[model samples]
Target: MLQRGVRAMRVLRASSVGLTRPAASRSLAPNAARFSSSRSRFPAPLVASPLLQRAGLFAAAAASTSAACAFCSSSNVAMSPVAEAAVAEKAAGQQPTVVLYQYEPCPYCCKVKAVLDYLNIPYEVVEVNPLTKKETQAFTSYRKVPVCRIDDEVVVDSSAIISRLRELVVAPTTASNEDEAALAEEEQWRQWVDQKLIILTPPNIYRSVPEALQAFDYCLTEGKFTPMERRLSKYAGAVVMYLIAKRSKKKYGIEDERQSLYSALDSWVAAVGDDRAFLGGAEPNMADLSVFGVLRAMHGLDTYEDMMRETAIEPWFSRMTAKVGSSSRTASN
Candidate 1:
């Protein structure tokens, strides 16, 4: 029973928040171009951000909208046939409704949401502060936020969610050869962001015993620390994590790892290039979304602001913020 409980605790810790950072902010330049170039020809549909998708907010909203429409009579029909069909496509599970669970100010959560918005996938957002909500207690079992529910399926982690989304959405193949190559490159970058870039978090954020203890205290006082533990126990656990990061740093050298992380970010931005607006060529693709999730951490932390500003990823950050800011305004209305 003790062992089982321990495993459950680990899972809970993993699911309560997103795994990426604010430093690697996503770009919407490509998406902006796509919309602008096609505005006269083909207007784009509303895109959902990762937070909305993971929290099941979009699905919930769609369900509400459909319910509202059910009250209309045939003689009072309002929606055009095409509009109705599009609604049905979303309602019938033709497109996945992503429900994201997250807390405000979490850089990782922001990163994931940026991707969702870039892709224009319809999603819902559920705001959850693990410290304050009992419902968030359920997350203690899984351990991460940016958890996604597609249809009835539950995906607990960001990388897993990305992989699943790629499988569901078919990439456009009719674009120019250059665009096709860009799409493939973007996909590869997405995988690296999830698998390789994510590993840098422990070293960067939890590098010392005091830092880990402070984090644990914050989590506890903030109400996120679990198991209803005494102060000492929580502090002890924080120390353990601190020790692990410290040891890892000693072996890997924190500065070297930081440099490598920056290099990866540089490579990712260079791949997008100035000519294109987005990583997925003209449309925001999985690559943009994936990278955006990690970059969020950098943006959230004041300490890294200068480093982020100095990098090639800065303009891309502006583009993504603009896109999300606009979407947020629309959603509020």
Candidate 2:
């Protein structure tokens, strides 16, 4: 059984007091942006900083606007769709509703979020309670996230969800042997990334005790946390995740975790090859999205810098960032 403390820590934003609107419907709230932007600079935990002192006051004011927050929805009121009523809608005329069940700090969730935006598919965010999983229990018997329900068709796992999104949104390019082979090859790499590559992130991000603290700091600050919760969540959560990262490192067969991370970056860059701009040639495919999404979790950490400075992955990572960042369009509420 998963430990209660671990689950509690994962619930960085899981609360009953305030509502959180899905990101697909609106731009990030200002304080929310600051929290996210801090990813680029692993600053001190908000608890230690002056910001935490008044964050509760700010949040109290924000609660009025965020009554329709990401985790919970307002009664009868819905998160407005991203595109026009016609554009984001499917052919059936009845507009499709996509609800994504996720945890705020999870990498797989980050991947699904990227692809949903990249494909311009609007989705409502349901922040699952890591401890109780109250939000996802009705739909899934097991406790896992990045579970996407597209209208009535529900999909689990990040890669599967991405594949489903592509099928629904991306136009079929061709029906040829070459196309078949290309897609097969992409699928192989995508699967490999899920099984082998992504496991590197946990260990690397939480490489050291201090590094682990910084990561939880980012996670806690990015979400809403009371001052008391911030301090307790930081130290206690950091120690737990740091130990967990070590176990993950061993499970992934990473003899030296940092070296394995560097190797993953180098291998991916090599796979993309010098002949093309991306793995999908001019544009990124599911393979590209999968890698980028998993890697997104490492942003702002010291590990991210080592991967960038030491490997050739940064150029491609930046390109993917630039392309994917613009894809998140806010719906008019």
User: In candidate 2, how many Å is residue 88 off?
Assistant: 15
Candidate with top TM-score is 2
Model 2 residue 259 CA deviation in Å: 1.5
Runs in model 1 deviating more than 4 A are: 1-98, 103-108, 119-143, 163-179, 208-241, 250-255, 326-333
In Å, residue 240's CA in model 2 sits off its true spot by 2.8
> For candidate 2, lDDT tens digit of each residue in 58-107?
12212211111111111111112222233344433232467777655567
How well does model 2 score by local distance difference test?
A: 0.55
Model 1: lDDT equals 0.45
TM values, all candidates: 0.55, 0.66
